[model samples]
Target: MFCVDALDVAAELALPAYFFFASAASDFAIFLNMPYLYPGLPSFKDMGDTLVHSPGMRSVRAVDMPLSVQDKELDMTKTRMYQFKRIAEGRGVLVNSFDWLEPTALKALADGVCVPGRPTPRLKEIAHGLESSGHRFLWVVRSPPADPADVFQPRSEPDLDALLPEGFMERTRDRGMVLKMWAPQAEVLRHAATGAFVTHCGWNSTLEAVTAGVPMICYPMYAEQALNKVFMVEEMKIAVPLEGYEKRMVKAEEIEAKVRLAMETEEGRKLRETLATARKMASDAVGDGGSSEVAFAEFLRDLEKSSMENGGCNN
Candidate 1:
């Protein structure tokens, strides 16, 4: 609805409108494939939490699908599905990501995986991961989804002592630092000391990780994030995935293993090197003579051309 509104306003004003996807191209591929994937998918309600293999995309699972799609109860075509479907009507879709950063995932998108990009789990498992992985961690813990009734009330400080397992914080106190959710995310990512990120598979966060040149421990919670995780861990070969992560209870062992793979092991080291290259590539794509810069100029030229054709809104 909003996309169409933008299109309508642009057309009314005799202007050209471009759609920008603020995520990875791999994820954008999935959005493009959704029209095909949705109908072909097995009844998610009947087979709750099962995986459905799709052509040119990663397998989608029932559980991680958003309420907007998985709920047979809702009229999906009238909602997010419709909104995404309308994206095809735009002049062009610009993804806030680069090509080399997600090569395999992008190839899969080109050859066939239109995968894109969750939610989160409890704190104990995370605390345990930092402890057992033997890696330094800085966790920014957000309050769980707010209840609508209390949404307006100012939140109180989280009682980490009670929230985490007994003595968990004490044990890892020196090794890990658990901060409030509002901590400076971009700055932290830009910091040199940050080795790896344990992230929630959001697109903005993914771009941040790319810019900062950090590997990840992907623990997707819900929505199309499962698609993002699959692309990164299975296809892109960039981040490590947390096993049994979708189960809502990630055991300490699994968490620790993934953390180590992202932060301390040879695999972690290689991931860091890959990320270093990606950082440079991302950096180059934004400055003078960058692909993004060139593309933006071309798009503007096209827009101006369109305006001239329409009797010069910008004339």
Candidate 2:
């Protein structure tokens, strides 16, 4: 069925009408009234920073949000108009995540979390295989350059084959895979050969690793990633941090030691077990009769009833 806002359009047709809010409609309205509250400049130079500030946005740096939200020249009037348009034409909005992953943000959104319905048996199989085979795994770091000098530079900074310490790549070449850009993270985490993830601890990546029951070798770049590392290593006991990266250049020996610790150390083994329990809990929270699932279903029903009563839904 087709949906539209504006009294003129709705009155002209007699079809089922609905409204959906992609973000928190009230929050957006409040934010729109205070455009000047947003910072004139982007905050940190990393994705995690932006996401961290998303829940409590207030005079936040532009870099801490999506690029479009940071554009100074974009007309706020037009942005609000488009936002309202989208909200006015759908039955309900669904976010692309699960509740256990972001309880605070999801609660604020007041929208349903549409967890994908899949067994993830492959992930389990891979984890089991890795446990049995006792292999070493290394996660090549993939991130945007932090230095301004490196920012506008071309992609050909160095070959994966050239950046390693002497004989380091040769020594682990049989067990390693070097990747640029993004990795098929869920797939890799589910792979039988992956014993650990050497990561920047981006929230999404961290969640993926945690959900897969894998331990992390955290190399936080900026923003909440650093904060998340504290929780992962200190609170959750599921990840470890690389300490000497204060200079930001991760040497081969440092990488070698951390990777080994994450894979074979006694502490690392304990972390794996802890993550396994967390993984199961997360799975249960999103399962058929779980809290997230029930909340989502209720959200849908509310939208439906609201649409019937108001001739359209409300955010």
Candidate 3:
């Protein structure tokens, strides 16, 4: 929850508090288990080829662990993971993920998983991949940061021509459209023409793509996104992983291959079909008398009872 730190205040007031985790259940599973798992392991930098076996998901390579712990000092990592101990103390936790989408991870919590920079070279490779895929596509391009640390710093608008592969735009003109800066992401995902999504596997985008019935090409750039990629591609079977992402340079050929697989092959079709079912399941879960609706009603009831017991905040 945005007010996670306020749990102590709520406890002092005898008020119940809940945590709203914005990521996947798999990530939540990892968060809950971190206090138990992290203290025993060596620094992530020293964990080469050692796979971490957390409950509810597959073993993950040390390199695929969350960026916050990957390079931080051991004490800092302990501090970060220790938050979960408090989180576990909360009345409950809510996640922005669906039940059908993450059974294992959800079961683990219930359960509860890089960093990369956006630079010019990676964008060019993405462009080449799009061009070579020969599929209809829409891309939103942003100018790369001058410094990796200043990724959010605003700058001049993107110059697609200078950033993309030479002749790439002209070659893909008929089959693709590239927009600058932003797009109505939700609307675009819901569009009938959107066959697949090439994404960084951010939780918001991952859920949107799932709801839209669009399969994905998981190209995680940072954060727990690599973990999301694993759940989506390996557990959910709703996406295909973009190879070479861990190396921080996803090759053009790898992108092309994933694109073609998601757009043209039988496997891709199956992924789409799986997503269609998932979309309906998502709808049902949130619809009237659905799981989400029932849970929300229960939450409101609990909130109301808690408020009354606390004397309606007058105390």
Task: Sort every candidate by TM-score, greatest first.
Answer: 3, 1, 2
Cα error, residue 219 of model 1, in Å, equals 1.3
**What RMSD value applies to candidate 2?**
10.4
How does each model score on lDDT?
0.72, 0.52, 0.80
Which is the leading candidate under TM-score? Answer: 3
**TM-score of decoy 2:** 0.53
Query: Worst ten-residue run, lDDT, model 1?
Result: 111-120
- Higher lDDT: candidate 1 or 2? 1
Q: Is candidate 1 or candidate 2 better by TM-score?
A: 1
- Candidate 1 — what's its lDDT? 0.72
What is residue 298's positional error in candidate 3, in angstroms?
A: 1.7
- Residue-wise lDDT of candidate 2 within 1-315, one digit each (tens)? 112344346546643444433332223322322233334433224333343333322233323233334344467434643554444344444443454444444444453221111100112222223233335554343333446334444454434444434454455557655556456888889776777887766667877887798888877654335545654676457788776443365544555566667776898788888888878877887888986688688877875775577676466
Worst 10 residues of 3 by lDDT: 111-120
Worst 10 contiguous positions by lDDT, candidate 2? 113-122
